[model samples]
Target: MPARTSRMTLGRLLGLSRENNRARDWFFEDSGNLLPHHRHHELNPSIPPLEVTKIALRLRHLIEECVPCELEESLITQAHSRVITREVVLAAKEAGGEEYRSCVVFALLVCSRWFKRQAHLELWDATLHNVRSTACEVIAKAIIEGEEDMSYLLHTVLLHRFSILVNGKPTPPANAVEKAVDLHALRVICSSGYQKCLQYLWRGWLVQDEDDPTVFVDYRGRDDQRYIVHLDPDRLRAPVYQNIARLLFSFIYLALYTMSINSVNPNGEFDAAEILLFLFTLGFICDEFTKFWKAGYHILSFWSAFNGVLYAVLTVSFVCRMIGLSYPIGHELRHSYDSLSYNFLAFAAPMFWIRLLLYLDSFRFFGAMLVVLKVMMKESIIFFALLAVMVVGFLQAFIGLDLAEDLKTDEIWFIIQAMANSVMQSPEFDGFEKFAPPFGILLYYVFTFIVMVILLNILIALYGSAYSDIYENADDEYMALFAQKTMEFVRAPDENVYIAPFNLVEIGVIVLFSWWLPKRQYEFVNDVVMAILYSPLLLIAAYFESRKAGEIRRNRSRGEDDDDTVEEWEQIEDQIDFEAEGWTKRCAAVKANVETDPAVIEVRKLMDEVAELKLMIAELKKGMDGANGKKKDDVKKGSEGDGEDS
Candidate 1:
């Protein structure tokens, strides 16, 4: 017969088995002491057959209550004989229902914990390996089932065994139960079904403590107080503010660049091509500005303010153009000319270039405003110079024609006229007629010559200096060249054609003068001239201020010392009067008063004396003190000092 059947038959046949069954009932009744080996095995092994039957019945009852399945029954019997294996547990899991499988798994955990008490090495090793493997597989399945709270179950079963294998042994099983649990967690993280599980693990599981460095709080729904991850506020704020500024600046630049291009003809229809280009360019600028803003620059505010005005002008100009109306200069042309007389005023009124310059110098409000005015005037000056040259050439031609026809002289007046016209018609003179001239015909040539030679040259130089300052690195040098080329491309009448060699030559001259000239020298020259004119007055004022400050400090120190001395004297007098009234007071107090009072008077007198004698005495005393210290140090050095002295 099978071992289980034999045991049952034995129990049924004996009357004494009834008493054994009662003892077994007592043994298996409570869960409190059921797990420990001592409680289960404490009964005498040499007892009657009735007692043995009773123990067997008690063991069977405990197994039924705790283990809950046929597999656990087989495991408990096999465990006693050291025959149970991981494969047997797995087979049980495969055969049983979900509840049975859970029960079997739990029974294996209890058995493994019980086996830890056994001295038999082989039994212990086999039980530990089997339990760990089975636990790993079961936990992996639980994880796959999309269970959110499997981590705790995993830790309770296989995590400890896995950690032991990792820490204590070198050759842990290749297909260990711990690895299966990890694989399951990884699979869950990758799956859409367990996204919340993965998030919980990421946010909650890996949190570090602020106070206790070594302690880790396990995941539990209860108030098991734990640390949380926090982002640095300053780090978060920097990028946000930077991006805002960048966006504002970019918008402003786009508005200004577009408006300036469009405002050439007030009554003309808005160019669809330019408008599209403007939008596209604005988009690109916005993208670049976003990058700059994200990097944490504060220059965007100036650009924003500038762009606001430029956008307003553009809106008004676009409205006027769409309505087939000119932007109102004034009631009369003369008044309009008068209003736009100063080159600085004209550039500032347009708003585009002025705003761009201001945006570029965002850190300094006043400085940015000045830069805008300067840049606007500089660009205007270049155009005016070109215009002046054209006018001069036109006049020379007219004069040449008149002389050739009216004088009836063999003058090369026609050649002069041709030369003047050639100069006027040069590509450099493209935008000269935009600014209306007052004494049109007569002053045109003279003005043109001055504009070309002086104003244009100055503008070129200014641009070169600005570019050099902005781009200090070798890479920046390349970028500066690229920017210059781009500007040339934009300025060219036909997009297809390259800038002419003559224009390049002119630009080169401007760049050379602007960049190579010693700016500091010029500044120094101006400073020297100003110093020569007003430095004496500045020196006088500075001297007066310094003297006043010194006097105030002196008076303060004197007053403080005087008050302290008066207080000291009053205290000494009160102490003396008290002492005279009481014989218990020391006569040394009176002596101290006399000595301290004289010394104090002497110190005050010394302070009042600002003569060289006190300084000499102080110097002599310092020297003597230093000498005495050196002698004392020498005496301490004994033999070395004596040798040095000899």
Candidate 2:
């Protein structure tokens, strides 16, 4: 039989699993401690709260005893050299047993109640805040080293789960699991001087050096540096910059399409703008097709579905426009096709503007609103399902009544339309009364009451509930969106990124000829072509990055910190008592007072004395009772002996 599927694999606990490490040597190793390795059914919410707390405390104590090590020397050397080979990552598993065990304990501690409330801050201070040989350092170093699969590690560890199991399990959590970027992780990284470590990872993704293909280049200032310094944090390759450019392209293309429909004559020959718009439309259709193929069912999200409808309309309009252009200008068919094309294109206007919200979600308000809207839409499904059944039942009743009376006075379509209008608050009661007089009017009134007063209110309540849930966690929801947006660029990476209309050029020209070329030659050709095509963007990026670097250097020379400092004073502007002591000082004072107060000292001493006295009294009482019991037993035995002799 295959090895039994184990819960809480040692590799995962040690933070060296396949998801986080590219090395093949990273495999599942069970700790072999049965109690600590209990399955989901044995522990979790199934157990009593007190028992759970005791177990969690035991795990915390075990974790505290572990001594985690810093990044290995070989890993540091490889990082400095700008390339950490797979051998190094694999080698770690063979010889770094103690280090891996330490990581396991740290992981357990982080995923527990030990990392909550005041303990949360203390844990951070103990492990991540200027503590040497820390688990946090291991993670940070892994990210900075840019080896194996660090993306998963970064994404996984920073994610906060509402319902995490104390012990690992194959089954997912039964309760609703709410995951978001950890605010504590964000705060700690910003405040505890891990800024450069994060920057290294960000820059690794942003900067794509022309010379290096195998490794992410780290651009050091010195000329003697291992990697090239020219493209350190290349703004052109940055997702933020690329996404902005794409948005601008879309805006311009949409504008041109609108102008062509309104201003340009339908029968006129294609102008430069019209031709460019057509090319962009084709590019968009192709991009959509590619996304659908790669993403499969995942592409069926709300935004994607909206784009589907928008693109479908655009496609039909374009096809009609093309067919119309082919026909003679004065022909009847040509005129009809032109009108149809314009009408269809005009119908897509609202979609174009509505699509703007999807892209503008980088803003906090927009991001949070999108989440709320998504929740509302999901909740509306119940309302729609109920409405559908009611509509069917009511429509059948109206249709059957019309047929039964031969009152062919109203058509089936008319009755259907009237019912829809009633739902919209414009009921035609006059027509309903003409059908069965009293019964028809009564039924119509009942339906209206049920729909308007009951169903509609239920829908409103559902919407309110959905909105409240999203609103309560609005900040976390927005952070999750932000993290997702960042990960989008990290995941599903394209070796040669061809954005929109430029993709047409890449597909039509480069891809056609690249089939016969060697892999290396093909990559070289792609790089050269991309460089030539995006030279203007690259030039702009270089200028900005250079300016930013200069600003950093100047700040360093002036002995100013390069990091962003949280202005405590500025944040207190709204406070009424500007002269009042800060919370930090007050907290410190309270703690000091509790520790040093004379009355508190006296109380503690008295309590200790009382506890000792109670223990002594209990021991003395036990001794006296044992002696009395022995004497009673002896006397009873003597009496029994006398009776036996008689």
Candidate 3:
């Protein structure tokens, strides 16, 4: 039978069987071969048997009349061969094994074919599961092979599925089927693959050989269409790089964790030492490539560099410990000396680099170079105070004025000797442990407190103030732009002359007030003073600006007689009265107009009504006092009876 004819017959049989048990039995057992003959006969006999034979005969007659096909001798055999069967499906499921991964591949092929043949099939759940499982396997292999293209596609698909799932809260269950797939398991299986893919993609661009342009082209253009249409390279690359950085940052955290544990028991293995080293190396490379420094350099770079140094030191110490345990020197004394030298390097390397990086990035360095000349010119007193503190500290340290009393102990002696060896061998940290005298100690403390702490705070405050002023001015500028555009469109006079400047001034005042005052005082000051100062200014400005614009519009609409002009004037006065009435009514109707928050509106209405009642009571008290005074005067004049009569 033709495929279409067979599908139509199947649909009709299912539809007709919905109302009749005998027809359903005939279709499921004899016509479709969904059940074996022995089981069917046994089940049928046990149950109150349906007249399935008669129903099958009727279905056969219908098919023969309506469907253009040769009548088959055995419908079960024809159905079994033509459509998906229980045995074929069971075999397919069984074929899916760890060693072969046959089930995943077969499922993908079957699902694709099913979708193509029956486009409206309600098989999204099954299809999604098959796709997810297949994708997991493919991603795992791709990760092992360092294939970025596959990894990118997998990540994109995951993100898309996540978005769909999140957006499907109120949607139908079928819409969220893709989101319900086991994403966590997939991610775990594909993590190594993603890492490898990221590594390849990051390094691929750097390996462009000037002698071979084709390699560069191939590297970039392998799936250009897919990248352009499906993925945002910047968005994808940024997160991946950040992930790499975070992984590197974890090394420092791991070291800290190890250190904390070691503080309790120093002999345990530092399991994170190698991991720290690996992460630091990866982070450094990513940081260099990403140019994150261009955006904001201070805290981020400093922290990254500091952590990198700390991890590097820990890694070196671990290496030294491993070597010390594994290998022995020629003599006992020599071995001890060598061990001390390695230990000294481990500590000194990190300290030296960390201090050097800080010194290089110091504000004093910038100040001396005259890089911030404008700041120096404007804030000379603050700058000089900071510089003097730094200079005093430097001189004291250089002169060795803060020497500490020597602690005479075997450990101290050993440490000193180890440092001497390190200095001799490494040519680094020549005078690292030398203690400065008392004056130097005082100077250092003063400099740290005065130059670093105080000066830094002042600079922060200055920058904050400047940022506020700029932001407020920017808002005013945007308002000006809006006003200019509105005027241009309406062909009106510069009515903004009155209103725009006042609005700008009001915004400026608010910004300045916020800057000077603490947050707690804002409501008090803004409530009492802001309305008094700004309300009248805004109202006056708006009145003049509106009048100016109106006059310009009226002039443009000239060339009418006195009667028409008088009519226009009357209309204008009517509009003015109407607006005045509207404003009064609107003040009364505000509680009804605002629907955003019912609770807030109710509270505001209560407050307003209370204020109105208080004002009305005050006015009534004043009128009663005036009337009482007049009655008292009449009584004093002996006209109390006449006044009462009147």
lDDT of 1 by residue, 184-210 (tens): 222222223233222222223311122
Please give the TM-score that candidate 2 achieves against the real structure. 0.60
lDDT of 3 by residue, 1-646 (tens): 0001001112222243434644544453353232122211111111111222222233223222322333232321232322223443333333333332212221222233332333234455444333323332332233233323432222221111111112323221110112212122222223443333233333221112223211111122111222111111111112222233333344454464345333322232234543444344444444433334433552244345665565465556545555554554454544654455345444544453343332222223322222233233445566557666665545434344323344332234433353334323332232333443444344435544554566656766765665455454443333222222222211111111112112343355567787888744543443333334334433443344334333433543563311123554566664466565687677676655442356777898999999999999999999999999999897787776778789
After TM-score superposition, what is the CA distance of residue 256 in candidate 2 from its true location, in Å?
1.6
Each prediction's Cα lDDT score? 0.36, 0.54, 0.35
Give the lDDT of residue 502 in candidate 3.
27
> Residue by residue across 484-522, what tens digits does model 2's lDDT show?
565455334456667777789789656576778876556
lDDT for model 3 comes to 0.35
Q: What are the RMSDs of all candidates, in order? A: 44.2, 17.5, 39.3
Per-candidate clashes come to 9, 0, 7
- Native-vs-model 1 lDDT? 0.36
Model 1: how far residue 71 lies from native, Å? 99
Better of 1 and 2 by TM-score: 2
